[model samples]
Target chain A: MRAVGEGAGGPKSLPLILARELAANLATPMFLIDAGGTLVYYNDAAEGLIGRSFGEQGEISAGQFGEMLQLTEPDGTPVRRRDTPAGVAFFQRCPSHRVLQATGYDGVRRTVEVTAYPLFGTTDEMHGVVTVFWETGG
Target chain B: MDVGVWGCRGSLAAPGPETIRYGGNTSCLDVVLSSGHHLILDAGTGMRPLGVMLDNAGVDEVHVLLTHLHLDHLQGLGFFRPLFRPGVAVHVWGPASPVQSLSDRIAIYLSPPLFPVRLADIPSDVTFHDEPLEAVAIGSATVRAAKVTHQGPTVGYRIEEGGASLVYLPDHEPSLGVTLANHPADWTSGYELACDADVLLHDAQYGDDEYPRHVGWGHSCVEHVVDFAAKANVGNVVLFHHDPYHDDDDLEHLLVQARARWTSAPERVRLACEGMTITLDANGVAFGAQAARA
Candidate 1:
């Protein structure tokens, strides 16, 4: 994995640095989810946002991760990883962004506007997705 | 045209730093018409800035339209500078619901318990016009109102002139029931309310997932906004009523999503931000940050 990320930066992983750089300055909750919508990377805001420690949750898949977040659409529909705004953005080839209510572990629901962008590798193959989640209001 | 939110709070003011960026002022929108006519959507706290703007411009005659008498919509009339100008004539329009006159409705808020002054103390020559949703002409433009979805009685306006139209329906919910089934083919659904208008400033206070929790809250979801924009065939659809929690970066992301989903021929969809000005002509639409001094 480190070799895949290293170019000329010695032993440092380029992809990890890229992810860190992307998530560093965001004031809102941001994360990088795999094509399966699994939890791969999360920012500091994500910790405070969903009320759960990211890495300690074990290797959770997208669907399982959504369950932990208690995610559901306004119409009482399930939010599968493939159907998440981020998921939809990737497969559907259209950006999916909207203000959504996400229920945390404590059952507290916060209004979030989520934006998802699809990422591709050098071979023009799909890699994963970068999702930025913003808590509504200042 | 230039649109400044001024007030974004609903029902009443939620004054605090948390509500400041998007504004805690109620639902006042200052729309500068192409003909330079100053149109005030509501007198919410947001109107204070507009009042100051008009004061500096020495603007006298102004047209003020009230959607309803919800406190947030009229709270700032007390602070509006133009209302006290000696030679200024302010025309107020509101729905002729079962409530008292428009002036009487606004007076309740200005009275002793709410504030020290009375509505009559204002020096401007104020005239109130009450009627059902009907067309009223201003200069060469036509401003018409239509009943909308809300708790108390409410109405939305459509302003058209010089082959350009701008629809203001600040307090509305996107649903297929009461409001949609009643209107004609042109103004029935959110799409109809916006059909071919140069700009449709519709209420998109929540996201699709937030709709269930906020059903009947008199606001639409971003998805519905995109849906309406696509179906209405409008030039551009601006998502108004920013959720108090969303910041500049969050709004930018939402605009990206709206643009991605928009499939109109000459597509236009964006989030409404303070100081954002939109210019429309026969060719297309253009957006820019309004000069701060303007």
Candidate 2:
């Protein structure tokens, strides 16, 4: 598990309020990433799915996390870090939904459906991205 | 028929001074028929206040029509006061799931460590129903559900009574099917729901510029809603499920843009705001001033 410092980009960002609300309440596994794709926050449910706790490992960059977990298509073809739902949602300023297989930090494999949407500030500026995912198969 | 907008914000509740005017609750509507039967729509955070009102009024029975099992749509169920009252009866109806029963799907959140109490522990005689394929009657009104394009299995609804009808389709993305080319037949189902409706409450979650980016997000822009309302010949089109970031002023501007783009009877278009009310009957549709809090 990893925890970003209190004054880190996520908690200090304008969209943190919404992200925190989602992190606290949503039952689905959710991850919040900064505009630059640094892993900012992952809720309890997300930690369960990722096989690690945010409190232990600290913040992980998108590239590092992708490389470590090795997310891939259902058939095991590698998926580019920039093409992940969170990546596309952040860069394209849109919402994206896809199903992919991921190897967790504990080496457990799961097929998950992920929906990622860009988070915007009050000024309509893109601030970050929120991804909600759930394991699909046993 | 009378309709009250208990909550209109989309995605999540945004309660604060900035959202006070339009409202910050998620998505709940209180619809009452001529016979005084209550029809609740969605179950967003707005349901909290609505539950208070219903409990105060001593209403004992509620028929909840959920469009889907999305969190924002069902979050208020746990807090709805009536559901905890021993004598109150609550019937929840929603789209059927192939993998799990509707009650089971809702119970996933209603029970265990997530909440302090379980659905079975609630004193209300709560019942969940998988809506039938055809229109069903509740009191004098007939309710019909049709599949709509969304991320999951979602449905739009139409309620008709006393020769007047109202349609509610709060989250929809028509372009998804049109773009896919594999589901063209589903495109016209939205128009069918709105056909000749006295009030058509449709999703207008984004503006023109914001829509292109959210193409597959299962929400519509104001322009698309207005165009559909015109083609369906709806008596009134209420732009609903406002984006959480849009303030009242932004909604007012969107209303202006919607009216300008409406091909016929621009005055018939309106924006859905929390606390707003509309009455529908054989004679015509009438809008009410914002209700004062009790």
Candidate 3:
């Protein structure tokens, strides 16, 4: 690897690299995934919302992230991996947007809106997805 | 693995008395693995001559990895000897376009009005791959293709084997409108394909003085290329894709300027010329023992 990341090995995919870069620059919270369903990255802005630094949780599965954040629907139903914006974008290879409730590691629950889009290279090869989210309300 | 530079000129083939020393064929490179498998980098005018030599050498199977479909890079496809030969397996790999299929795009040149022979008319068993399933293994080399900063859909290649890696971005401009330093390694275009490779053959088509006029033309000036190489921290940097307008003397001047500005390691930088073959192994990069010196 040319340059090391906090929790994951350096991304070799072009789209991943560009995604990671764009994620780092923005003030909004962002999450990244690989094609095989690995949660490869989260920006520093995500620390407060996700309740952990990327350094502490490098690469994890979507289910693991769900468990860590304890996500649920606004009506108090637990969210499945396929129902989240990231999951829909991954499985459907399309954009996803939704409002959901999440219980942070610090025991604070917040309503959040997530927008996700699949990352594809110039040849239409799927690299992963980039998910951007923000706290909508308490 | 050995990297042979068949042609290093960019944009167009400028073969004349003034450009004689550097030779005037556009972007073509030849990589021969220890197992005798050949990987051709581009199908520029230089590939025509390289094809002749490969045919004479009796090499049957070859993989041609094209960066893009620019005319300078695709001009030599019809003239390639192996594409015309019988019983030869010619696998052509290129960047996939969202709109057109690889076979259809390449046929624009290989077919009727442009050339007498259609792509299907070629005798060799030709296989086209617009998409490489991530990293594909060829002989002893693992090749990964990723899109880079270029005019049309272009991709840089990273070939790794035996702990050595060679990155080819013969037509790249990582510094278009923004300062590359403001971004992380992952943010910069072409950085992922080039990071930590033993050899990085990148585009150095213009000097700093000539760059402002050609912004977004998709070729790097000397300053940007050298800066990018230093930032990537590769073992060696071979300035490739020489501008056709720059004569041999001008290229030397650029080399001098590059070395002068390369604060990290001046000795690690050099220019790409026709017939310069680089060998990479566990021992690291060995450059230009067979180079055609200017």
> Which DockQ value does candidate 2 get?
0.01
Q: Estimate each model's TM-score.
A: 0.61, 0.66, 0.78
Winning candidate number (lDDT): 3
Model 1 Cα lDDT, one tens digit per residue, B1-294: 455556655556656655544445567777776667777888877788879989999988888888877777787888899888899989988866443666787788878989888878878898888732447776556788765556566777887766778887777764533233232233233344467888888777776667779876777777667766656667778777666556545556666766776754424676665556666555556777656633
Q: TM-score of predicted model 2?
A: 0.66
Position A37, candidate 3: lDDT: 77
Question: Deviation in angstroms for B106 in model 2?
Answer: 0.4
Give the per-residue lDDT of model 3 (tens digit) for B1-294: 998888899999999998887789998998999888999999999999888988988889999999999989999888899889999999999988878988899999998898899998899999999746368999999999878777888899999989999999998888865576554565578886788888999999999899999988999988888778877878888998999889999999999999998976888889888888899998878877453322
lDDT, each prediction: 0.66, 0.80, 0.85
Please state what fraction of the native interface contacts candidate 3 reproduces.
0.47
Task: List, for all models, the DockQ compared with the true complex.
Answer: 0.01, 0.01, 0.30
Report lDDT (Cα) of residue B181, candidate 3.
Answer: 54
lDDT of model 2 at residue B74? 91
The per-prediction i-RMS, to one decimal, reads: 27.7, 18.6, 3.1
Q: Which digits, one per residue and each the tens of the lDDT, describe model 2 over residues A1-138? A: 111123333223324433654475767788877766677778789888788887775677867877877889999999988788987886777899989999888889999999999876423545577899999994
lDDT tens digits, residue span B90-195, model 2:
9999877657889988899899888889877889999998764368998778998765666676778898889999899998775543432232221244655667
The parts of candidate 2 lying over 4 Å away from their true place are A1-138, B177-186
Higher lDDT: candidate 2 or 3? 3
